[model samples]
Target: MSEPILSLEAVETDIAQYHILKGVSLSVPRGQVTMLLGRNGVGKTTTMRTIMGLLRNKAGQIRFDGAEISGELASSRCRAGIGFVPEDMGIFSALTVEENMILAAVSGAPDRARLDWLFTVFPPLKTFWKAPAGTLSGGQKQMLSIARAMIEDRKLYLIDEPTKGLAPAIVSTMVGALRELKRQGASILMVEQNFAVARALGDHCVVMDDGRATWSGAMADLATDHALQERLMGLSMEAG
Candidate 1:
C-alpha cells in the first residue's frame, strides 16, 4: 500500500464552544480515493474543515506530505498543494464560468493542456464559458466547482458531497470525471452521501460517528459487509 499523503492523529475540534470532533484520526493514502462515510451530523464535514485548517484542531496533529501542519493557516495549506471543494460548491455566482476558472488558477493563467482536459471532463463548462455561474444548473455549478479545484495541480483534493441534489445523469457524469481524475493519479479525500458514487470511487473507507472514527477498512470490505454498513451509517446499502 502507498504511504498516506495526509494523516490525522487524535484530532479534536470545537466550534463556538460546541465540540464537533473528538479524537478523530484517519489516513488518506497517496494516489487513492479515501471516502469519509457516516450519517448526518457525524463530524465528516468538520473533519474535512479541520484538515483544510478552516477549523483548527484544539488537540492532536495534522500532517501533510510528511510535515506537521497543525498550526498552518488555510491559505498556507492551499499553497502547500491542498485543494478544497466545500459542500456549498463555493463558486462566485456573479462571475462567469471562465472568470471563476481563471481565479482558481494559481499562476493567474491556466495551463492550456490542463484546461482542455477539464473541458473534456465537463463539456457544459466549455458550452457556457461566458455565462454567469449563477445561470448554470446545480450539476453544472458542481462541475464548475470541481473544475476550479482541478485548474491547478495539487498533491490532494478534499471534496465534499459532489453529487448532492444532482440528477442521475449529472451524477453519472461526475462519476466518470472523478474516475478519470483517479486514473490520472489524483489523490482525493471525498465525503459523499451517494453510496453508489462512494462505492465506485473509493479505494479505502473511514466511517465516522459522533466525531470519531468508528471503522476503517478497504471499500470492498465495506461494500460486501451489509451489517457493517448498517452499524456505521445506520442503513444498509439496499435500504439506503
Candidate 2:
C-alpha cells in the first residue's frame, strides 16, 4: 500500500502522573476511514487527542502528509490541514449554525460546492441551516461538527466518538456521510464504539487497549473473527 496520509509510530502520552498512551501506533491510508475501536477507557480518545496535539506525546513519532508533526502546535496542525471533531462536538452554544460553521472556515470563502455536497449527504444540516447549533438536537450538533471539519479542506480528519449520544437513525446518516467523504478523497481516522457502524464504514480496523494497539486488520477479516472482537472489545458475536 502507499504511505498513509496520517501515521503514528510508538506514540506515548502522559497526563499528570498517569501514562495514558503506551506506544500506540497506527496509520490511516489516504481516502479511507480507519476506525479505532475498543471498550471504553481503552485509550481510543487519547489516541485521537495525541494525534491532534491536544495532549503532547512523551515518546514516538506522528507524521501528517509525510512530515513529522509530533512537536507542532495544535493551531499549526490545523493550518496544515488536520481537522478534528472532538467527542463533545465542540460547538459554540451562543453561535448560530452558520456562524459555527464559519468559525472553522479556512482562508477561501466557505466552499459552496462542498456545502451543497454536505447538504446532500447530511439532510439534517440542510434542514437546520438557520437554527442555532445549541437549539439543534444532539444528532444535529454532531452533523454540524462534522460539517465544520469538512469545510477546513483538511488532508486528514480525526473524529472522536462521533455517535456518542445520537439517535440510531442519525447515526446511520452520519455513517453514510462519512462514506461519502471517503469517496471524495478525504482520509478519516475515526474513533467509533458502535460495532455495526464501524464495520460498515471502516476499511481497516485498529483495536486499542490500555494505551496500546492490540490488534489491527482489514475490516472484512475483523468481521469474520469473533474471537478477535471478543478479545479487544470484551464483546462476543452472539451479543454483537
Candidate 3:
C-alpha cells in the first residue's frame, strides 16, 4: 500500500492524571475511511482528540503528509488541512446555519461550489439556511456539523459518531453522505459505535482496547468473523 496520509506511532496521551492513550498506533490510508472502533471509554475519542492536536501526545510521533505534527497547536493542525467534527457537533447554536458555516471557513468566505455540494449531501442545511442551528433536529444538527467541516476541503477528517441516537433512516442518510465524502477522495479517521455504520463505511478498521490499538485490518474481515467481533468489540453485530 502507499504511505498513509496520517500515521500515529506509539502515541500516548494523558488527561490530568489519567493515561488515556497508551501507545496507540494506527494509519489512515489516503482517500479511505479508517474506522476506529471500541466499546465506550476505551480511548477512541481520546485518540481522535490527540490526532487533532486538542490533546498533546506525550510520547511517540504523529505524522501527517510526512511531517511530524505531534507538538503542533490545534489551530496549526486546522491550518494544515485537518478538519474535525467532534461528538458534540460543535456548532454555534444561536447562529443561523449559514453563520455557523461561514465561521468554519477559515481561509475566507465559504466556497460556493462546496456549499452547494454539501447542500446536496445534506439538504436541511440549505432548507434552514437562515434558521438558528439550535432549532434544527438532532439529525439536521449533525449534518450541519459535518457540513461546516466540509465547507472547505481538507486533507483529512476526524469525525466522532456522526450517527449516535438517531433514527435508522437518518443513520442511513448519514452513511450516504459519508459515502459521498469517500467518493470525493476524503481520507477520514472516524470513531463510530454503531456497528452497522462502521461496517458500512469502513474500508480499513482499527479496534482499540484499554487505551491501545489492539487490532488493525480490513473492515470486511472484522465484520465476517463473529468471534473476533465479540472478542474485540465485545458484542457481535446483530442483523436488522
Identify the candidate with maximal lDDT.
1
TM-score of each: 0.97, 0.95, 0.97
Model 3 has an lDDT value of: 0.92
Please list the residue runs of candidate 3 whose C-alpha ends up more than 4 Å from where it truly belongs after superposition.
Answer: none
Give the least accurate 10-residue stretch of model 3, judged by summed lDDT: 231-240
Q: Per model, state how many residue pairs clash.
A: 0, 0, 0
Candidate 3 accuracy as TM-score: 0.97
- Model 2 TM-score relative to the real fold: 0.95
Give candidates' CA RMSD values in order.
Answer: 1.0, 1.4, 1.1
Candidate 2 lDDT over residue span 1-240, tens digit each: 789998889999998999999899888888888889888887888889889989999999999999999999998999899999999898997888888878888666788887888889888777877787889888888899998998857888999988887888998888888887877788889888777878778888888888999888898788788887777777864454
Residue-by-residue lDDT tens digits, candidate 3, 1-240: 888999999999999999999999899999899999988999999999999998999999999989999989999999999999999999999999999999999899998988998989888888999999999999999999988888888999999998989999889889999999998899999999888888889999999999999999999999999999889877897742
* Lowest-sum lDDT 10-residue window in model 1: 231-240
Name the TM-score of candidate 1: 0.97
